[model samples]
Structures are given as structure tokens and as C-alpha cells.
Target: MGEFFETYRPQLIYALIVVLSVLLLRFLTNLLYKWLLKQELKKYPNEKPKAVNWVKRILNALWLVLGVIALSSLIVNEDKYDILKHNFKLILYLGILSIVTIVGAASANLWFRVSINRKIQNAEDPTSFKFLRYIAVFGIYITGILFALLAFPSLEGIAKTALGGAGVIALIAGVASQEALSNLVGGVFIISFKPFIIGDIIKVTDTMVGTVVDITLRHTVIRNFENKMIVIPNAIINKEKLVNYNLGELKICERIEIGVAYDSNIDLAKKIMQEEAQKHPLILDNRSPTDILNGNPVVRVSVTSLNDSSVTIRAWAWARNYSEAFDMRCELLEAIKKRFDNEGIEIPFPYRTVVLKKEKETHKNHDAGQTAE
Candidate 1:
């Protein structure tokens, strides 16, 4: 053992130097990163120091790369480690690329998150933020991977070969996955235009009224009134005409119809309907421009139609949302019914009058016979 130690003392010394150098580099990197981070945090208390963090990580990665290169340089003078001298540079390059790729990808993701947090503050649609983050991370990592692959001469040839056939492969893939491609495009448009956000009440059709629960690259999930989820393709959603109840303002105009006897006082009935609407808890106090243009009251009442036996009274009222509007309409109707009963305003039922035509004909014939006699 002593002879072996004596023979390999120089090699052991070289190994020890490399190990110590790497450890020292790591320690310095960590210390520098923390100091920079602390300074950045102190300087911008309100703003996120994510960029600083990313930079620190990148610097640490570069330090490791530098240490590897230094080690390679130190070991090159030793003839016993010929393989390390020749191939270590390639290995170090690949290692550095991998580290840089990972750190850059993570940094990009963190940057995106901070951007989203700042720009989309209090945004109801986190799905858009999440999708955008995924796309950004994917792009960054893919770019990094491509760069890493080019570090090797063999992979460079493979990459060139793949690129040569890329056009044909892309065309075939496009044709094969046309629907998926359309959906992906639609998702992009939806996020950009923001036709509807998560938690919005939407009506795709008469039977498909629901709240938007989730929006993905390919599909949107709607939770219907019956608590069942309806998964709709993004392409279909883009093409179809849909109603977003919560798009502009949360308030909605609700119409409550009531029928009263023709003989009842129409003006009094209108007043009662308006009163009932105003008294409802769910009704909104705010009036719109249309309301002002029409000289609209807090609750509007009009004679919508006259039926065979009754006159239809339509009352328009506003509520904060669809649910509130529905409840307001129901409660207003009940309250109006009670008010009508108290005020002696009758709500008429459907009835038909019939005359005995045969009896009248018999009587007429008898009268004619007596006159002839």
C-alpha cells in the first residue's frame, strides 16, 4: 500500500486539487447568490426578485462550468489520464448545457409566473395564466434541448437529417391531427380575446346553460345546472354563438310577467308589479343607459299583451347576476300575487261561454208555426 501511494502521489494530488477547487467554487457561488438575492429583496420590497434569483442560478451554473474547464486544464498535463484529457471537454460541455438548460427553463417559468401575478392581478381566469406558463416552459426547454444536442457532432448530423424530412412529417401530422390543431388554435384565440373567463355563466344553446369550470388547450368543461360536466371542444366553442351573462357587467335585466282580469285597473296593476320588483331583495338598484333613455324607473312595468280573457303585464327589473335575477323574478311574482289579492285586483282564469242553439231553434220554429196558423 505504501509503494502504491508513493507511485500515485502526483495523480492523487491532482485529484485532490480538482475536488477542493469544485467545493470552493460551489461555496462562493452560494454565498454570492444569497448576497445578491438579499440586496435585490431589500431594494425592491414590493416587486418580486425572481429575475435576480434566476440570474444567481445561471451564475452558479457558469461557475460550475468554469470549475470543470479549470480541472480539465489542470489534468491535461498528466500523461496517465489521457482519456480524461481528450474526452473531458466534451463531457463538461454537455454537463454545462444540461445545467444551463434546466436553470434557464426554471427561470423562465418563474418569470412568467411573476409576470402573470403582476399583470393579471385578481383575474378570474387562472386557466389562461397556467396555459401560457406551460407553453413558455415548453418553448424554453425545447430550445435549450436543441442547443444541448448540438454540443455533440453525432447529434448535429441527426438533427440535420430530421430537419431535411421535417416538412413532409409536419404536413402529414397537420393533416392527421387537423381537429386537434384547430382546437389548439381556438384555445389561443379564446385566451387572447377573452370572450369568457372561468366562473362565468354561459349559454351555448337553449339546453346547454352552465358555468365555465375549466378551459384547456383542446376542450372546455362546463358545469350545468344539474351539476353535470359538459366537455366541449374548443373549436366548436369558437364556431358556435354563445351568450356570456357575466361578460360585461354582472347585472342582468329580468322580466316578470303577470296576467290580470280585463276589468282590473291596468295602471294599478302596473304600479303593483313595479312595487313588488322594487321590494325584492335580489333586485339591483343600478339603472343602465337604456333605462335612462326610456325614462325607466327603478322597476319598469308595461302592458306587453292582451289575451282572450286577461291582460299581460310585463315588469322589467335588474339583478346582480343570473341566480339573483331568477330569484328576484320568482319572489316578485309571489309578492305581486299577494298584493293583487289584497287590492281586489282579480287574476282571471280561462273560461268559455256556451249557448243552447237547439233549444233556441225549437222555440223559433214553434213561434213561426203559431204565426202561420
Candidate 2:
């Protein structure tokens, strides 16, 4: 046993040192990770500490890799140790690059969340901010990859070769991804010129009416009335004519048209419509100061058209938003109909007169016989 210990003493000592070093490294990394998580929580109480979690995972992975390397070094011969020592700088560079990439990406995402919160507080548009977050994250990853390639002497040569043919490679890639590129460009345009932001109610096609839920790099997501998500390609959406209800002014004017019997008192019907609209809770008083001073009616009712059986009257009712306007219109319709019935103002239906052909022929024959007599 003494002889065995003497022969393997160097290996045992090296192994113990490696183990102690790994334990120390783990303890220090845990301390750092905990501090970072606590700070993140303090700064953003509502948000999850995703960046700190990512850093923790990265540190764990790094420690595992370093532990493996250190243990393996104990068994390797002198020549192999020299090789490991020679390439240690390359390994360190790659590890540092990985850490920087993850940290940078996490920082970009954090910045994006902060900007979005500020925009919401200020009531500013956040469409551009949302789209730019993806761009920023992607750029960080690409930059990290480039740095990694430059770190290795062999990969540095390859990078130069690739850069030399970048033009041709880019042309081929562009041709292959034409539609994707178009969507990207469309996304950029949409961000630059604010057409509709998230939460805005918009009509893309005659059949598609929904609220903008999310705008991504390639597509826009809309949640329709049925609560189904509709994904439209940015390229197509940019080309189509859009109707945005929540654009400049969120107020909407709802036109309620009701037909009344021609014999019914038109003035009474118009007054009832105006009264019902004014009584609705969602109705907005959008009249200017000048109009208010002039005593303009809260709801404007007008004779739109005179039909064969009825007179069509239209009431312009204003509401603060599309949802309120829709609700107000429906309630007004029901209320006005009841009021019309109570006030003896009739809503007319179509009337058509019909005669029997046989009766007409019989009458004509009787008239002819009487003429002959």
C-alpha cells in the first residue's frame, strides 16, 4: 500500500486540486447568480427574471465543462497536457463569446420590455418597439457568431473566404427567399409608418374584421370577434387597403336608420329617435364648443329618404369607441321601436294588391253582353 501511494501520489494530488477548484468555482457562480436574480427582481417585480435564469443555466453548463476538462487533464500524458494548455486560450475565447451573446440578447429583450412599458404609460405607439426587439436579438446572435469565427485562426481563413463571395451568396439567398425578404421589408414599412398598433380594431378585407393582437417579423396576428386568431402576411397586409377605427380619433358615429309609415307623424318619429339615442349611457357628446354654444341637438335626426310605403329617418349617434357605438346602436334600435309603438308611430311594411284573372275576364264578358243588349 505504501508503494502504491508513492507511485500514484502525483495523480491523487492533481485530482484533489481539480475537485477543490471545481467546488470553489461552483460556489462563486451560485453566489453571483443569486445576486443577479435578486437585483432583477428588485428592478422588475412584475416581470419574470428570465435573463438571470439564462445566466444561471449558462454558468452551470460552463462549470460542468470546466470540471470535465480538469478531470480529464489528470489522466492525460505530458504531451496531451501540452496540447490542452496550448488550446486553452481558444476554449476560453469561445466560452466568453457564448456568455457575451446570451447576456447581450437578454439585455436587448429587457430594454424592449422597458420601452414598451414606458410607451403604454405615455399612451404612445408601441408597434415599432415590439418589432425592433426581434431585430435587436437577431443582430446580437449574428455578431456573436462573427466574433467566434474570428477567434480561431483556421476559422478566420474560412471567414475571409466567405466574405469574399458574400455578394454572390447574398444574391442566391435573396432569390431563394424573395417572399421572406418582401415580408421583412413590409414589416419595416409598417413599423416606420404607423398604420395600426396592437389593440386597434381594423378591417383588412370585407370578411376580416379584427383587433391587431401581435405584429411579428413576417406576419400580423389579429383576434377576430369569434376569438380566433387570423395570421396575415405582412406583405399582403401592407398592400391591402385597411380601415382602422382606432386611428386618429377613437370616437365613432353610428348611423341608425328606421323607416316609419308615411301616414305616421314624421316629426314625432324623429323626436323619439333623438330622445332614445340621447338617453343611452354610451352615447358621446362630440359637439364642439361653438356647436354647443349654438345649442345643437345631442343626437341629430334627419329625413334621409321617402320610400313608397315609409319614410326613412337617420339618427347620427356618437360614441367614444367602436364597441360602445355598436352597443349603443343596438340598444337604441330596440328602445326606439318600443317608443314608436307606444307613441302610435307606425313602422310600415310592404303592401301589394292582387286581383283574380278569372274574375277580371268574367267582368269583361258581362260588360260585352250588356253592350250587345
Candidate 3:
């Protein structure tokens, strides 16, 4: 027992130092990450999510790197154990190569994630870049895992039957996950032909309303005007009715329907409407900058509905801004009411005529006889 312990003492110390180094590095990296995140949050107030994700992934990668380096060094020092000294050089090389490769892949993924997000921050379409990010991460992880698996000593069997069986097993596994394969293919289609992007208002159906907040392999994410998020399957979005506000001009039409008593002059009413519309500061007043005598001006009036008591004239104007449109509509309506009242024009209310049947002679006689009695 003494001899065995004596031989293993140096190896045990190396193992202990490796473990301690990795743990210490992990703690330090986490501390640094939080500090950096706080600093970034102060600079870019709206970049909390990006900063948080960046710091987290980078810290994890740093810890992974430290762990891999410690393990590689420890594995190389197995010679000092006095019993493992005569092992082939292949073991040491393999250990170092394997550890270095995994660390490299993780480092690449971290770099890609950070760099891509930076580019995306400046893009008109951030969702496309997000798809690229997913691809980068998946590629790195899968390549690393494949390399790790192939490096396993058991996979190097000399039997041809075993190699053939492994291939067959892989094929079977691939076939069994048909839906997963379809999702992967669908993700590719979605990225290549982007129907929508983040921050774009989209309508998928009659009721699903929101902005495209995120997209993933199996699902697309949407956040409604109420700040509620909904996850829809990619397959559904691929086949549903979708309208993208990102691709079109943002001009929205504000409409007003007004009517006046038939006795009022229609020309004067139209003139008053045109005057009210032009007074608002938000209305675009320039049609040609110079009026042509015969040229029909851009008339905002449309006598749309003809009701019994009044003729409903619809007035519409376009505004370049969405948030300002509703307020403009309200102002225009108040202006119209004040102008109409000033001009002695009444907005007619819905009216009806009641026709009473004529009383018969026999009823009149009965009433006269009662009075005489």
C-alpha cells in the first residue's frame, strides 16, 4: 500500500491542481461577465438582452477553455505516475488534440455569436442574421461532437461487420426522426425566403396580430400590441396568410364620415370639409404646388353612403406617421363640428314619420252620445 501510494502521489497532486484551476477560473470568469454586462447596459440602454446573452455565452466558453487546457496538461503528465510512463506517444497526442479541438470549436461559436449579433444590431432585418447564428452554433457543436466520437478507441474496431452495422444504425436513426429532418429543411427554407423579420407588424390570420419577435427551427415567435408573446409553428406560418408591414410604405388612411340635412347646400358642406382638412397641421396640402384651372384637385371627399335622413360623405386623408394618425382624425372631427356650427349647418339626425289611421264616423258618434247622457 505504501509503494502504490508513493507512486501515485505526484499524479494525485496534478489532478488536484487541474480541478482547482478550472473551478477558480470559472468563478473569476463569471464575475468578469457580470461586470461587463452592467457596463454595457449603462452605455446601450436598450441592449440588455444582447448584452446578457453575450456575457453568458462568452463566460461559459471561457470556463470551458480553462477546463480543457487543465485536462490536457494533466493527461500529458501521466508519465510522472511511475506506472503509465511506458505508454505510447499516441495517447498523449490524442489527449491534447482532442481537448484542443473541442476548445477551438467552442471558441469559434462564441466568436460567431458575438460578431453576428453586432452585425445584426445594424441590420434592417435582424431575423435573417439570427437564423445564421443558429446555423453557426449548431454547426460548431455537431462538428465538435462528431470529432469527439470518432476519436473514441472503440470505434476503431477491425471487424468490417461492425463498421457496416454502425452505418446501418445511423441510417435507421435518421429515418426514425423524419419530422426532425423536415423541420431542419423547413428552417432552411424560412431563412432563405424570409417572409418576415423582427419588429415587423404581421397578420397571420384574421385574429393573430403582432410583430415578428423571433423565429426558430420548429416555431416562430410573435408579440402582440399588448406585449403578449405567442409561439407559432414554422409549418403553420409557411402555409398561412401572412401580411408584412415591413415591406410596404407605412402610410395609413384616417377616415371620417359626416352627413348634413338635405336642406343644407352640398357644395358649401364639401367646401367646409376641405377647409377643415387643410387647417390641420398634419395634412399634406401640396398636390401640384400650383393649381391648374381644369385639373381636378386631390379631393378627400367621397359621398359613400346615402341614408334616409342624410347623405354620408366619407372624408379620408393619408398621414406618413402611424401614431399621429388617430390624433389627427380627432382634431379634424372637432374642427369640422365647429366650422359647421359657425356656418348654421346642422348635422341631421335619423328621423321617421308615423302615419295614424283616420277615426271612423261610428267612433265619433259613440263619443258624442256619451257626452249627451
Candidate 4:
């Protein structure tokens, strides 16, 4: 055992040195990464510093390369060491390329998010900016991959072969990624057409009512009234019929429908509804200059239908946005109901009349028996 230890002392020493060097580099890299991340968080409290993660990843790769190089230099023969050294340089080049690409992507993404947040705060449209950000990030990743393939000597032949078979590869990829490509195209169409921007309240289906929160290349995110996020693929959402509450006009005309007893005064009911809607804070005066001049009412209340048990009165209440409109309508409903109760106007339930045919037949048979007796 003593002879073995003596003979292999140089190899053991080399291994220990390589391990320590890698550990030291990793420790330093982690410390630097954590410090940078802390500073970044201080600068942007809401944002996660993704670039630090990229830095850490690249530095780890660098330590790995250094360890391999140290090991080769100390333990391997001269010929093998030279070959390993050449490979080390390639690895170093690739590592640097990766770091640049990943860091640039992360930095650009962060910048875009920050810019979009500012736009949102300023009440500006961020739909185009968000779309462009996704496109730019995707393009950067693709370009990096292509450059890496072209720059590496060993991958050059493979890249050339792939290019030569571009047509076949495209055909195969098109078939395999048809849905993904459709979603991408759908996302482009949505951004270009501007059906619904972020912050717009849209009803995609009867049950899928929400505000558009985010639109990405693959999907759109909606935050519903319940505060739950619903992720729908771009293609599916684009194909579905949706009602955009903020498309052309931000103001919404909410129909506040109420039913009162048939005996209730129709004019009084209409006046109560109009007055209740007009007094709400969120209610908007959507009357135009001509309308005001023509003496049009701010809140228009009309008798829509006279049902069997009650009269259905509807008031058109305008609000600046969907959220305000919803809140306004709810408050108006409660207020109007209380006002109607105080004014001696009753909201009637659906009255139903039922006749029993068996009871009528029994009475007729008893009358026939009495007449016979």
C-alpha cells in the first residue's frame, strides 16, 4: 500500500488540484451570481434576474472545461494533451457563444417586459410590443443555433447536409408541427387584426368570460372574474367567436332589465330605473352634443315587454368600461329594487294556473248520481 501511494503520488496530486480548482471557481461564480442577482432585484423589485442564471450556467461550463484541461495537462501524455487542448478551445468557443446568446436573450426579454409594464402604466397599448418581443426572442435563439452549427468545424458538414435536405425537412416539420405553426400564424393574425388587446374584456364563450391578460406565440392568457388564469391556444381563440367589450368604443351600454307587477305604474317604474342608473358613480353620460340638444335622456328606460304576470322594463346604462358597467348594473339593480318597494311597486313572481281533470270528472259523476236518485 505504501509503494502504491508513492508511485501514484503525482496522479493523486493532479486529481486533487483539478477538483479544488473546479470547486473554487464554482464557489466564486455562485457568490458573484448571487450578488449580481441581489443588486438586480434591488433595481427592479418585481423582475427576476434571468441573466444571472445564464451567467451561472456559463461559468459552470467554464469550470468544467478548466478542470478537464487541468486533468489532461497533469495526467495525460503529450500527444493526448495536445488533442484535448484543441477540443478544449472548441468547448471554450461554444461556451462563450452560448453565454452571449443566452444572456442577450434574457436581457432583451427583461427590457421588453419593463417597457411593456411602463406602457401599461401610462395607459398605452402594449399588444404590439408584447408580440414583437416574442418574435425577437425566438429569432435570437434560432440565429444562435444556426451560427453555432455553422461556426463549429465538426458541425459544418451536418449543417450543410441539413440545408441540402431543407425541402424534405421542411415537409416533415410542417406535418409534425402543423398545430404549432397554426398557433403561431394565429397569433400573428390576432396582433395584426387587433380584435382584442390586452386589458380588454372579452367573452369567448358563455362560460369563458375574462379579460385578455397576455398573448404569446402559442397561447393567450385570460384572467377571469374568479382571478383564475385560463390558457387557450391562439389558433382556437382566433377561430372562436368572441365579443370584445373595448374594441371600438370603451363605453358599454349595460341593459338593466327588471320586472314589475302588471298593476305597477309603467311610467313610475321607468322613472325609478332611469333615476337609479343616473345617480351611480360609474354611469357615463354617453349622450352626444346633438342628443343633449335634442333633450335625450342620459339613461334611457323603456318598457321592453308585457309578460303574463309582469312588465319587463329595461334601462340602458352607459359606463366607461366593462368592470365599471358590471358594478354599476349590480348597484342599480339593488337600488332600483329598494326604490320600487318603497314606491308600492311589487316585483311579481311567475304565476301559474293548474286545473285537475280527475277532480272535475268526479264532481260531474256525483251530480249525475244525485239527479238519478
Best of the candidates, lDDT? 4
Clashes of each: 0, 0, 0, 0
State in Å the error of residue 145, model 3: 4.4
Against the hidden reference, what TM-scores do the models get?
0.56, 0.74, 0.53, 0.75
**Model 1 per-residue lDDT tens digits across residues 1-373:** 9999899898678767877887787788788778967875785566566655665666567656655665666546566466665465665666566667766676677666676666557654576776677667765675666566666777776545434556434643645588988887888888898899878899999989999987777788899989999999999999999999988888898888889999999999999888878877787878778977888689878999989999999987888999888777777777899999999899999887777999889999999999999
* lDDT assessment of candidate 2: 0.86
Q: Name model 4 segments beyond 4 Å from true.
A: 1-46, 69-90, 146-172, 353-373
C-alpha RMSD of each candidate structure in angstroms = 10.5, 6.3, 9.6, 4.7
- The collision pairs in model 2 are none
TM-score of 1: 0.56
Q: Estimate, for each residue in 164-249, the C-alpha lDDT of model 4 and write its tens digit.
A: 65643563365558899889889999999999999888999988999899999999999999999999999999999999988888
By TM-score, the better pick of 2 and 3 is 2
Q: Report every candidate's CA lDDT.
A: 0.77, 0.86, 0.66, 0.87
Q: Rank the candidates by lDDT, best first.
A: 4, 2, 1, 3
Best by TM-score: 4
The lDDT of model 1 is 0.77
Ordered from best to worst TM-score, the candidate numbers read 4, 2, 1, 3
- lDDT (tens digit, per residue) of candidate 3 on 252-307: 66787799887887778888887777667787543554554556444477678777
Q: Residue by residue across 1-373, what tens digits does model 2's lDDT show?
A: 9999899999888888878887888888889988988888898888787767777777767776766777788778988997776566667667778888999998998899799889989988788889999889976886677678877777776555445656435643645588888788888888888788888999998778999988888999999989999999999999999999989899999999999998999999999999999989999999999999999999999999988888999999999988898788889999999999999999989878898999999999999999999
